[model samples]
Target: MARAHWHFPRTALAEHYLNVFDVGISSHLAFIAPRRKGKTAFILQDLAPAAQQQGYLCVYASLWGDPNAPHESIVQALEQAIDACASESKIKRMLSSKVRKAAISNEMLGRVEVEFANNPKSAGTRDLTRIDDLVTQLEKAAKDRTILLLIDEIQHLATSDDFSGLAHSLRTLLDRRQGRVKSIYTGSSRHYMHLLMSTQSSPFYHFANLHRFPDLGEDFCAFLQNKMASEYGVAVAMGSLVKAFGDLDHSPYWMQRLVERLVTEKCPLREAMNYTLELLDAAEGFEETAKTMKPVDRLVFLELADNGNPFSRALLSRIEAQTSNKGIPGTVQRALARLMEASLVSQIKKGEYHIEKPGLRRYLEKQVGSAPSR
Candidate 1:
């Protein structure tokens, strides 16, 4: 129960972030990474455990878990933590089953997982005093331990103006708590995270010292290699595994799926990787997401993926010829905006972007490559 054997612990990284909190560099820390790159796993498995060991009473939740009302999710975590803290025995487990259920229930970017919740029945709203009151109660409940709130998929708060109130209230509440309540927030998009935490207009502006969640490296691959050898008796070549990890966008979840096939089928690495891509494309529903885009949107998304300037004259000319949209700039702007809203793309600064769903690039390529010449 210390740490999952399969989980390669980043104890130093975890402690480093907490040390920042301890020194008052910032009580709030925000880390952004694309989906399925092990952000959630690191927060729950590595970071939370480390904070608890440091005598912090941690309450963890994912806004994606209860998409309808993100406020409710935070309140629930606080309430759960309070209950758990009241009982010395339950405090150790720390709402493990409940928090993880939230994590697993919504794993994909915006479509299948937390993305499913973006279109809530209504705008995201939080009861200010309720969240404040819960945290206050938790402080009393936790006794000597500092209260730590770990919120995942925090970028959703920046997705709409509707969440502005919740964003404002939570930041204010945490600020008022002063070091009483410390938090670590994990987000899936740097673009949205920028809108959430970096923009001066945002309540969270300068509220949390932000960090890019580092991707799992070769050590992660080595761990997988050992796990496969020791548990599954599958001998996978090291170079092959490393290349596949890069091919899979360095995502641990997909890599693990590739490993699963190796264990059961005892198949060649290439065969397993192909199978994983097929599974990844399907799981991400890239085809279905594409069906929703405009022709220009599809073209622009792929252009960004291929590292072509979307506003280049050639691309604009192509868009005009293909879609017959005369307002080329307007059309392209809307297309990029739609892709961002769809959670298919993310902006780095102004014009630059990182594909939120990289798998979509492959899908678009197949569509283009398979098309009859126009």
Candidate 2:
């Protein structure tokens, strides 16, 4: 069993579902959720083992690149994957040599070259060319093995071509009789991903194995309980911990923070509940100020949080009117713009909005629930 904090067995259910799907080839999976929900951990836990077991080369890319381009992100992930898989001395030696060679001979470099022992003539430049070259390199890397490409924060990818190109490139590899590649695409912003993969204009339309990383469930909670018992040598009150999760309101980040605080304080579960509420109360003024922001900003925050985790623009507008007594469309939109600027709300999907904070939903729920039953 993996560490309770780092791995989720619940992901196995997703893997099983993907394997059973009739998508007709190696599946592209998207694990979508809000931030700090263990989506990245889930990807790492599953993708790493699958790559090693299937004898596949895995590239885990972060889209937040040096220049913030999709292509750059891919290259970064490639270099990392190569360095990680390469023999330690060999990688250091090869990279050192590549840098040395590039510096010494200024050969009209339109593209950068990462040459391996088996493939010497490869020069990768431009996004498309680099992906093509990388695929070639990955093929060489996975001699008698499969290849797995795991891209994280894929929502940062802009343009239909960015994703479409990826899908088309993967299609080429999968179409081959000697194919040895599988992929998992993950993003924290589900709304953006839906627009990318589900939209008719998207190159990745129907190209991925859609998977939702669920909240920590009973089994995971039980795992946490066992870990607490063994690690601290104290039997945790499982019921209290469960109740704590409910009270923290099912936010994974907050849930983890609560556990950390409990462990640090050595507080009993019941005591921890009181302590947690106190923490929330202590932080309320600042949090409320953070929400007060501007009228438009506050409106956007409330709209997203109150409407749902994510709401389409139309839905948001509808709710704005329903909730506002002013009945001014321009006023509501301006308020939303302010919220977006303040970073109190984020557009997870194009033309859709979502709250960026945890525990905020409950605060809004109470406020709305008490509003003259409107």
Q: How many clashes does the backbone of model 1 have? A: 1
Off by over 4 Å in 1: 1-4, 86-89, 98-127, 160-162, 292-299, 313-331, 372-374
| Number of colliding residue pairs in each model | 1, 5
Clashes of 2: 5
Candidate 1 on 184-277: residue-level lDDT in tens?
8998877778888889999998888899899899988999999889887899888989999988989887887888788889999999989999
Runs of candidate 2 exceeding 4 Å displacement: 1-11, 17-26, 65-67, 83-127, 159-180, 249-251, 270-325, 328-358, 363-374
- For candidate 1, the 10 contiguous residues with the lowest summed lDDT are 117-126
Task: State in Å the error of residue 256, model 1.
Answer: 1.4
